[model samples]
Target chain A: MQLARKLAAKLVTGLVMIWVVATATFFLVLEMPGNPALAQEAADMQHGMSPAQAASATAVMFGFVPKQPLPDQYRHYLWQLLHFNLGVSIAEEGVPVSHIVASAAPWTVILASFGIIFSFLIGVTLGILTAIRRTTRLADGLTLLGAFINGVPVFVIAIMLVFVFATILAIFPQGGTVSVLETPGWNAGYLGSLVVHAVLPVACYTLAGLGAWQLTSKSSVITVLGDDFILAAELRGLRPLTLARYVARNAMLPLFTILAISFGLMFSGAVFIEEVFNYPGLGELLIASITTKDFPVLDGAFLLIIVAVILANILADLAYPLIDPRIRRS
Target chain B: MTRLARQPGPDPAGSAAAVEAAPDSVLAPDRGALGDGDAAVRVRDLTVSFPTADGPLPAVAGVSLDLARSHITGLVGESGSGKSTLALTLLNAVPPPGHVDGGSVTIEGVGDVLALHGADLRKMRGAEIGYVFQASQNSLNPLKPVGKQLLDLGRSHGERDQRVLLRRARALFDEMGMDAARVLASYQHELSGGMRQRVGIAFALLLNAHVVILDEPTTALDMLTQALVLEIIRKVHATRHLTTLVISHDVGVIGDLADRMAVMYAGRIVEEGPTVQVLAGPRHPYTRGLLTAMPRIAGDVSEARPLPGRPPDLASIPRQGCVFRPRCPLATRACAEAEPPVTVTGEHRFACFVAAQEVS
Candidate 1:
């Protein structure tokens, strides 16, 4: 019953966070220099409409009315969102924002999940090794390497990887999610090509994220190593495997919190990585919406990102008590 | 069991010689000569040192001690006096920044701990010796259930069957006077301080080790809890027939629980004898000072005078003289010229030039 209450509290907090983000995104997007109607006017003018014609067309586009009041617009947007309607995209003309978001969200989720998991696995392994062999020369060298990799920005690493593997070596494809000719499916050929295309972007994410996991795990392992329990375990004459398991399990507790926060971050944080690769992910969609002043699409993309973050945070909160028993008592 | 009265002034050399001739008179009544099986642990000339930036800092100088079987030998000293270091050496598991420089710790029926390595050392630690760390709460893995931690210790020591391990843990907790089911399900933090300490002791006991080393077991407990824990320790010591080394700065604790006691000063044993005899008529000045410093309820209401100076730094202890001479109230020119010789009277032995002579 207490667990249920704790979980309910977490869910409510997450929902409130998403609501706040939605409201803030609405106001921030609307407050941008040019309104969507004005952007529509500019686009129509570019298509050879006279200024008066473009203005009248935009007026008609708004249902023969000028812009609504801020409160009315907010109510309209919220009502539309309640009915699962994200409206039609202005930039892509007739494409529903929901459809666009649905297509792009999968790619982002897949890439970030793979990147985070693989980096976490590799980083934790290396981190445990370094912590165990802390004073050794090899561990010192690894520490220096981790610091170097962490210091460099993700985009820079992405660009450098592109230069080395794509441009200079001409080995992998430079950018894009998949080949234009191939049909998207679970079949071997399509999936293989998809993986090939994801290589660079995923590599960028992994390399960029590896350092934080390694550093965090290293510090955590070091801290647990100092714990008296560890000494007691050692004194008990536990074998190397048992000792390692005990140490690693305890050390991973702090990392769970980091993992939760990082999972939330990966949604929006993928923007630069997606842009660098031109991957058809939510990040690219958000960037495209911003450039063309597609407010509906922008709002939908922001909402998806914010919701992903909230959901990840909730999952973390739920998993915390399971991993750390002390939490359950309090 | 006539109580030996506290002696005043000095004794003649002839009496000291006569006492040394019949050493067993001061030995524990149940113990015979120091046979291989009689002494559960025998540490001889054990020296441990830490490597600092400047040079080697000796934490435990060449100190020797014998722990008789099924008896509690309390090693009492102020912090940094190498009490904890000496305890760690029993398992040959001195933590980093410190290493066993010289000496041998031999457990009867087990090989020399200092010389053993790899599997041999591990086996020795598993089957022969156990340790209870000073900080009781942190001495347990906070993330694991107490029972699971105990079970893991048992498993590593070759207890393979899960049911057997669980039963053993439950029995040990029961032995510790805790609710077996509740304690088994609880994490370290869920248990109170005293409970945690008892569980920590239970962890050590799970191995069924013949020798248990507890470092400052009652240092942080409330008076009642401390007394209870001490009682439990004494009971455990008696019931298990286990040679026990209890290290603490609390002389009162040692006085209460130990059958024999050794007082450490600046990395060396300053005084050692039967607990009652040593507390009643301490032969070494440092031991006398420690006894005086202890707060008493029955004595006159006088201020407890703490030892004046801090312990000598391990890095720069004087090499040519008695380490305690600088702080000694009875220090003379001879005390600074060389290390004091061990003076023996019956089972009691002390390292002091003046105290030995004056007391004798």
Candidate 2:
């Protein structure tokens, strides 16, 4: 009964978070300095319409209508959101914002999820080794490397990786998700090309994030090693493997919370990497919409990011009790 | 013959002649009383020290002690008196920065502990000498259930059958006076202090260790819990015929449970003897001071005196003379010039130029 109440409370909080993000995005997108009608007209003219014709078309679409109050616009947006409608993109003229978001999000999910998991595994293994062999020269060198990697910005690392792997080596594609001519499918050639294209951006994301996991895992394992329970385990003459299992299990608890929160942050934070790689992820769409003053697409993309983050957080909260039984009591 | 129990302090004038005759040979005779084969655990001239910015600080300084077979020997001292360090050295498990400088800790039929390394050392630890730490609460993994932790200890020592491990754990829990099923399911936080202590003892016994070292076992426990733990120790000692070393600061607890008692001060054993003999006629001033400070149920409470002056720092412990002299009430010029020779009377062994003479 208590668990049910706690879960219900979490569900309510998540909905409120989504609602707040939706409301904020709606107002913030609409309030941007550029005139949406003018931007739409300019975009139409670039697509081969005459300037006068594009201006008249933009006016027919929205220039004649009076702007609604913030509250009224919010209510309208919320209503559309409830009915699974994200409206049409003002900059793109006829494209539905929901359709744009749906197409872009899966690419971001695949890239970020794999990148984060790979980085986490590598970081944790190195962290454990460094912590166990703390006094050695190898541990010291690894620590220095982790600190150096962590100090550099993600975009800088991404650029460096691209320059080395794609620009110089010419081994992998320089940018984009897959070759333009290749069809998306489960077949080996298509999948291989997809993976080949993902290699640099994924490497960029993993390298940028690896240091944090290594530092957290190292510190947490160090703390667990100092615990009397560990000493007790040692006194019992436990096999090295058994001892490592006990240390790893206890040390990983704090990392679990960090992992969950970071997983959520990675989706939104993938913006820079996506932009750099020209990958068609939601982050790229969000950035493109911002530049074009595409209010509907901007709002839709922000809502999706917010929802994904909130869901990840809720999953983390639910997982905590399962991983750490002590949390279940409180 | 006069009993030293009622005497407030050693008589200075009478001790002069005996002090002159006292030599190292007098102390060496008592090693034969153990008959060479009787000592379950023998520690000779054990020295453990830690490295600091200043220099090496001796924590256990040239201390020799013997635990006779199937006896409960209580090591009583204040914190920093090196009792815990000495206890840990029995398993060759002294925490780093503090290493065995020089010592030979030998268990009969098991060879020298300090000489053993790796697997041989591990085999000796839980299998031969079980150690229960001072803080019972921290001694257990909070994440694991009691039964699983116990079984893990068993499994680590080559106990293969899960049924056998669980059955043995339950039986040990029952022996330690706990509800086996309930405790097996509960984690460390769920159990009370006394229950945790009993479980720790059970963990030690799971390996059927011959010499169990309980380091300050009842230090933080309440009166009732303390009594229960002491009773459990007593029962384990009696039933298992295990040679036990119970380390604590409480003289009363030691008095209640120990067959033999050794009093430590400044990393050295100042006095050691049969518990009754030591309590009745403590030959060393430090031992007498401890006995005098102990609160009795019917004593003049106002007369209970706390030992004056703090214990000396290990780094600058007097290299030439007795370590306890700075705090010794009976210290004379002779006590400061040279290290006091160990003096033995019957089975009682103590290091004091003045007190031993006065006792004789």
Candidate 3:
């Protein structure tokens, strides 16, 4: 019953978000600021326009289209959103917003997916390690470095990595998802190149992420340390490795909850991070669409990212019960 | 776990000679007339301290007690009385920031428990001295089922196979009058608090340690469960001849299970005696006060009198003085300058400048 209520609430929240985005798209594109048609018209002028067509274009650019009311236009836009009809790009003529986004979504997903997953994995692992070896010199040093690295912004890390690897040391490409000469494909060769390009960004971001991720396990460690079972386990006098593993396993319960949140945050957070590395991810495409007033394309990317994050959070909530039995009974 | 209680403890040579000459060692009331029978644990002048901004403050101050074979000794004190600190000291689990300033915990065969470091101490802790903590629920792992956890416990001690440990775990469950398979398969959360306590008991006892520090084991258990657990402990103590230290604030609990009891206040043992004797006629003013303080449904109304004033703060206790002097009503000028020497009887012992007057 609680799950049903939670899902129903999420559905309502998602629809409310869609409505707001659609309304914002309508006002900002049609009512406010610069003309969407102006960019199209400028391109059209170079190609040559008939007098009637030019006048019609100029009037539309300055809001002459009263044929379709604002509500009707909003409805049309919402419908287009539902049907995956992200309209043409204003920056590049004859280019559809959906098509540009579609071509670039995978790159972003790949970069962000790898980056987030890798960051979470590495971060959670280090956190657990540091938490377990809490008193050791190694753990102390790891905690110190993780805090320092994570304290710095992602862009700073990205730029620094770029300077060291791409500029001064030229070990990897300066920016971009794949090499300029390379054609992106599903094959291993292309995927391998993409990964190679992704390594520094993943490492750079994951380092910052590790501070929070691993710190999660610290609580788990403390919890495990307090567990009477450990004392009992100690009484049973097991090997050092077994005792450590027992502590780690019990501690892993809460870390799972932290992992879910880290996954969501890192994925969405990769947007700016993607642009910084010049990776052709959805974030970069969304920026391009926004600059040219391509509302449909921009809205699609915005809505998708928002929905992705919310869904991830929801999934995390739903999954917590399965991982820790104590939650389900509650 | 080495069997400290394997051989029956004999009388001292003088007592043995007297018994041989008079045929009364078997009926002798003075167990102390006998020599020490390889004290299962000998904690000598133990002082455990925790660091603060000012300095390291002693939590357990010069607590010297012997836990002998086939005996149940109860450590009785209210919270912050340093009973738990003393217990932790015996286990050698005083974490970082806490230091054992001066003490030696000598367990038979295991040697100095406080001195033993790394793997040596770890080995002794589980195999030799089994421990039961207060919170039974959180004491066991939640995710892992009871059986697997038990199996792993055994596996840690070189019993690696699931089948072998599974059999042992089932045997233990059956022995505890619980369903072997159900308890084995059930997770920690699935069981009730009492059931978890039972599992805890099985875990501690199955390993067969001579000394088990049950730090308020039944504190969180229900009344019926407490009775059942106490009964089980008595049964185990009798059958295994285990040396048990049951720490509790409930004097009734100590009276019920302990052969001898030690009363702690401000990290010092104010009184120690046979449970029945202490309850019936306490020698220390604090002990008498504790007895009088216990709420009664059937006792004479005039006899009930609660002990006034709280226990002293061990952190800033006077360097040369009785720890209980601040609260001890009968304390004289002599109590302020030095701790009174322990007064001894056949088996009972009391530490108070006014012990002479508190007793008959």
Candidate 4:
């Protein structure tokens, strides 16, 4: 009953957060100088229509032009959102914003999931090893390496990796999710292309994320190692494996929440990584919509990312009690 | 029972004076010549030291003791007196930056405990000598249930039949007057202080370790709880027929529970005798001062005077002569010149120049 109440509270808070973000983005996007109607007006004027004709034509074509009052536009947008109707993209000429977002969401999710999972595994393992062998020179070297990797920006690493592997070595493809010629299906050939295409972006994500996890986990384990319970465990003559389990489980508690939040961040997409690799993920879609002044698609994309982040936070809060009973008691 | 002479030559200046007066010094007690033959554990010339910025300083300096079979030996001292360090040395587990400089801890069935390493040392710790650490509340893993930790302990010791091990644990908890199943299901935080202390004792004896040590078992408990826990300890120690050592700073706790008691000051045992004899007639000035300072039920509350001067830490402890010379009311020029010798009288032994001369 307590758990159910806690989860319900977190979910309600998450909904409130989504609404706040949507309202803020709504006003902020409208306040920007350009809109799809203006861009259309410019295009029609370039086609030799008079200014008056283009303005009237835009007004007729786009029923909800920027000229409409702010309150009415807001009410209409909220009504559409409530009905789960992200209206058709003005830039895409009748493609629904929701359809565009749905199509683009999967690529980013898979990439981020792979990156976060792989980094978490490698970081946690290395962190444990480093903490156990803390006094040794090798552990010191690993600490220094983790710090260095953490200090360097992700884009720098991505560019260097692209330059070395794709540009110079010519070992992997430079851009795109898959070859244009391959029939997209569950066939071996198609699947192989997908894996090959994903390698660099995934590698970039892992490399970018690995350092922070290693550093956090290393310090966390070191702290637990000094706990009085650990000393008591040692006195009990516990086997190395059993002792490691106690240390690892306790050390992993703080990291679990961070991992969930990182998973949430996956929807926002790694703009630099996706851009560098020319990967057709949500980040690329977001950038395209932004450049074209496609207000509907941009709003839809923002809403999708915000909802994912909020939901992930709720999941983390709910799952905490399962792993740590100390939290459950409170 | 065995007698331990302070090992000589820790300091060059003090060694010459000590050697010259060796015959009349009364420092050396006849080794294994006058006490009980069946000692469960014999500690000989044990000296543990810790490294500091200046140099290595002894925490448990040149100490020797015996835990007679099936008897509770209480070691009493202020914090930092090294009574706890001496207990850890019995298990050969002095924390790092501090180590056993020299010692031989011999148990009945097991040879020199300090010599055992790796698996042998580990096996001996929880199997032969169970240690109930100070602040039993913090000694338990916070995350795991008590039952899970018990199973971990059993598995670590290569116990093939976990069922038997758990049955022993449950029985031990039951004997300690707890609802065994409920306690086993609960985490450390779920239990009260007294309950945790009892659990500590239960864990110590669960593996059938005949030799048990409880370090400040009732330190943080309320007076009523302390009395109850002390009773439980007495009951458990009796039923198990276990050789036990209880370490505490509170003289009242030791006076109430221990059969034999040793008084420690600055990493040295200043006095050792039957608990009743020592309480009734303490020889060393520090022990006398401690007894005088204790708040007794019968005595005038105003008569209790806290010992003058703080207890000496490793850095502050004197380099030569008696460690208690500065605080001793009967200090003389002779007392400041060299260390006092051990003056043995039947089962009681003490190291004090004035006390020995007075006895003579």
Candidate 5:
């Protein structure tokens, strides 16, 4: 019953977001002064040749056909979206935007999956520990450490790790997933290298995320401490350690919503991490698309991320009923 | 059989003596170690204080009680009576900002409960000593089925097979007037107010707990449910021979269940004695006032009277003085200054300095 309401609410919120973002994308693209024409103008200024033919060619490059009205362009844009036809990338020399994203998407997905799983495991455990030892020197020390790591930006941490491992230690490769000779294959050695190369980036993201996880856990413990259910558990003569685990576990119901946000945010710093590791991911495609103004690829990447977030939120909403009774028949 | 002496009153000692005669139940002389009152639990010179914004607020102010086995003792008081505080001292489960500064919770055949900790205390809980909270909602785990909760309570002290657990749970439900199967399967939120209280009691009694400290078990229930739960408690007590400590602010409610009743004002035990003795002929002014205030449902419509004033603000009470003196109707210059120790006779105890004079 609750799942249905949550899904409905989530769907409405998602649709509203999609509408606003789609509208913003339309206006922002329109707001850009001269797209391919400016590129053509700049090219012409650089070279002595008149490049007048390139001006019309450049207009075609931006998917704006000759003399099309603004409404006509928007209609075409919607049609392309309906058909899932992300038009050819300008910078990638006519390569379809879908292929470019798909090719790089796997690596980014793998890295993010590992990072998310690792963060939940270690971060949540530390959070539980922090909560159990609450107000003690140990809890205080852990909070300080978690806060320090979480306070720092992911990019800064990634770079620092890169310097320490690649530059100073020289035990690991500086960038990319595989050796030049190995190329990309399913071989054990090559797979190991890919995982090894991905380690620093994953650690960087997970470590940066620990602060919030710990804080959430501590607050959850504090919240659960007042619970009549927890007191009930104590009166049942549950071992103290067992009782604490119950507190930490039950308190994670609300935290699960935030965990879903973390799921959505898994790829948030993908652009930065992918750059550091040289892993061929959607982040690279996104970066290139932004710099070269590859509108199809840019729109597709942004839209995909927004959709994933919507999906994550919906999943969280459904799971809430199963976790908390107040929200169940609630 | 011999009846205890009664102090003379204007109504005549002979007429009062006729009313004071014991029922047929007392015809048989009680036996065992408990017959002579070797205090199953002795709490002496216990003074617990909680720190407030201003200074330390005394909760169990030099309180004492001798709970003999095979008997029911009532700890009564209005809201802030410190009756609950006196009850908690027995378990040593006092939370932050409060501590047992000058007292010991000792049990006969068992060691001092206050001295025991870690495994010793944990073992004592739900085994020999059971605790029931005022709110049944606070006692039962919301997420779990009642059967599982009952089984867990037993798991602490002794092992109970699933069969035994299920059997006890069914018996408990049957005793409480609930459907055994449905109640055992149901969650805390699923049960009605009365059903939840039944479940709480079943959990406490599953281990056949020797010392059951019930802290106002019927506070959250409606009048009908309160009477029903109280009836179940009375039945369970006679059947199990459980040493029960029932806490309540209402004098009549305690009057219904407790064999002996103790009246607490602020943090001090103003009066405590045999239930009928205290109720019919209360010695302390506070106890008398509390009994006088009880509204007679069927007779003497205008007899009910409210106490003259509110209780004193607990935080501002002086370091060493009678806690109730500020509002005590019989308070004299002597009562205002020095706190009177609890004067005891047999099982009856009252703290008022004017108790003897009032009775005479």
Candidate 6:
């Protein structure tokens, strides 16, 4: 009963958060200086159209806001949001904002999820190893490596990877998610090309995030190692593997919260990473809509990001009790 | 794991009988008269040292003693007096930076413990010698249920029948007066302080180790709980026919629970005797001072004389002469020249130059 209540509370908070973001985005998008309709009209006139024709074209193309009062527009936007309907994109005339987001969301989610999972796994494993062998030269070397990779910007790493692996060596594809030669089906060739294209962007994501996980997990494991329970376990004559399990399990508790937050933040990083690789993820869509002043699509994408983050946090809260028994009682 | 308890522990008949009797009759007065060959564990000139910036300084200086078979020996000392280190040496698990540099700990059935390493060392720890750590209330895996941790212990030691191991653990929990099913299913935080301490004992004895060490078993407990824990330790020790070592700073605790008492000053054992005899007539100045300092209900409150000078840390301990001479009211020029030699009188032994001369 309590679990259901907690989940209900979290969901309500999530809805409120979405409403706040939607309201803020509506006002903020409209408040931007220089009208998009006037800009579109000027561009249309430059194409040798008459002033009347340019105005008509601009009215038809840039229909981001309808002719209505501010309060009515907000009410209409809220009503549309309630029905999960983000109106048509202004830039990509006649394309629904939902349809555009639906196509792009998967790419970003897949890239970031794989990157986060791989980085978290590798980092935590190495962290446990280094913590146990902290005084050794190899551990010290790994610490240095983690710090170095973490210090470099994700884009810089992405650019360097491109230069070295794609440009200089010609070992991998330079850009795009898949080759045009391959059909988008359940064939091996298509899937292989997809993986090949995701390699550099994912590598950038993993390398950029790996260091923080490694260092945090290392310190966490070290602290757990000093705990009296560890000594007690040792006294109980637990095998080396069993001892490592105890240390790793306890150390990973605090890192779970960090992992969830990292999952949410990965999209923010996707903006740069997806651009560098030219992968058509939400980040790419966001950039394209922003450049063209597609306010509807932009607002929809922002709302999607906010919802994704809220869902991740909610999942973490629900999963915490399962991992830590101490939380179950309280 | 249960097979460990089946091994003959000193005198089976006497120990079995002691189990059924009251706590007071658990330790027969004349058991201290037992010969050295009858000892369950013997430590000879044990010196544990820690490396300092200057050099390796001895934390537990050449201390020799014996734990009589199926006897509860109490080691009393102030903080940093090396009592805990001495107990740890029996398991050959002195914390790193400090190690057993000299002496040997020999259990009757097993060979020298200090020489054992890796698998041999590990097997000796829980299988042969059980250790209840100081503040054992907190010495549990916070993430795991008590039962899961018990299973982990069983798996580690290659116990073929998990059912048997668990049965023995539940039996121990029952004996310790806990709701076995609920406690086994619960985490450390779920149990109260007394319950956790009892669980600590259950874990120690779960493997049926014959040689058990309880380091400050009642340190963090309330007065009533401390009494209860002490009673539990006494009952458990008697029933198991175990050779036990209890280390505490409280003289009252030692006087109440110990069959044999050894007083440690700094890193060395300054006095050793049967509990009754030692409490009656303490030969060492430090032991007498410690007894005097203890507050009592029956005695005049002002008569309780606090021992002068604070206890010394590893670096602050004097290198020459007797370790206790600086704080001794009867210190002489002769006490400053060299370390005191052990003077034996019947079952009691003390290291004091002035006391030895006075006895003569």
Using all chains and alpha carbons, the TM-scores for the candidates as numbered come to 0.91, 0.91, 0.85, 0.92, 0.85, 0.91
> Chain A alone, TM-score for each of the models?
0.91, 0.91, 0.79, 0.94, 0.87, 0.92
Which residue pairs come into collision in candidate 6? none
- The digit string of per-residue lDDT tens for model 3 on B135-240 reads 5546676777777777767766665677877776677667667888898878888888778877877777655667788889788888998998898888878877
TM-score on B-chain, cand. 5: 0.85
lDDT of 4 by residue, A1-330 (tens): 877887788888888888899989988877777777988889999999998888888766654555668998899888888899877777777778888999989999888999899988998888888898998999999999988988999889889889998999988888799987789999888888899889999999899999899999999999999988887787878887888899889998999999999998897858788889998889888888888877888899999999988888888888888889887777
DockQ of each: 0.56, 0.61, 0.51, 0.65, 0.37, 0.60
- lDDT (Cα, tens digit) per residue for candidate 1, span B155-261: 78788888988887788778878899999888877888789888878878776777899889887788899888888898888887888999999898899889999
lDDT of model 1, residue A106 = 87
What residue pairs clash in candidate 5, if any at all? Answer: none
For each candidate, what is the lDDT?
0.81, 0.82, 0.72, 0.84, 0.72, 0.84
TM-score of chain B of 6: 0.90
Between prediction 1 and prediction 4, the one with superior DockQ is 4
What is the total number of backbone clashes in candidate 6? 0
Residue A199's lDDT within candidate 2 is: 91
Best by DockQ: 4
True contacts kept of each: 0.69, 0.51, 0.62, 0.56, 0.32, 0.72
Greater TM-score among 2 and 4 belongs to: 4
Clash count, one per candidate: 1, 0, 4, 2, 0, 0
lDDT of 6 by residue, A1-330 (tens): 999999999999988988898899888987767556667777878999998888777656744344457898788788888888898888778688999999998899889999999899888888877888898999999899888888988889989999999999988898898999999999999999999988888887888789888899999999999999998888889888999889888998999999987887666558888999999999999899888877888889998888878988999999999999888868
Please identify which of the two predictions, 2 or 5, would achieve the higher TM-score against the true structure.
2
Which of the two, 4 or 5, has more DockQ? 4
- Please give the lDDT score at residue B48 for candidate 4: 96
* Evaluation by DockQ, superior candidate among 5 and 6: 6
Task: For model 3 chain B, give the 10-residue run with minimal summed lDDT.
Answer: B25-34
Could you give the DockQ of candidate 1?
0.56
Model 6 CA RMSD to the hidden true structure, in angstroms: 5.7
* Sliding window of 10 residues with minimal summed lDDT for model 6 chain B: B23-32
Query: Which pairs clash in model 3?
Result: A127-A214, A229-B139, A235-B126, A238-B156
Candidate 2 per-residue lDDT over residues B1-360, each given as its tens digit: 111121222222112323454444454422312434457777777899999877888899888888887899999998889988898888888998789998678775576778888988887678777888764548887788888887777777888888988888889888888899999999888888888888888888887787799988997889988988889899988988889999989898898999999998888888888999999998889888888887777888878898898876776578778888888898999888987767777677888989766766
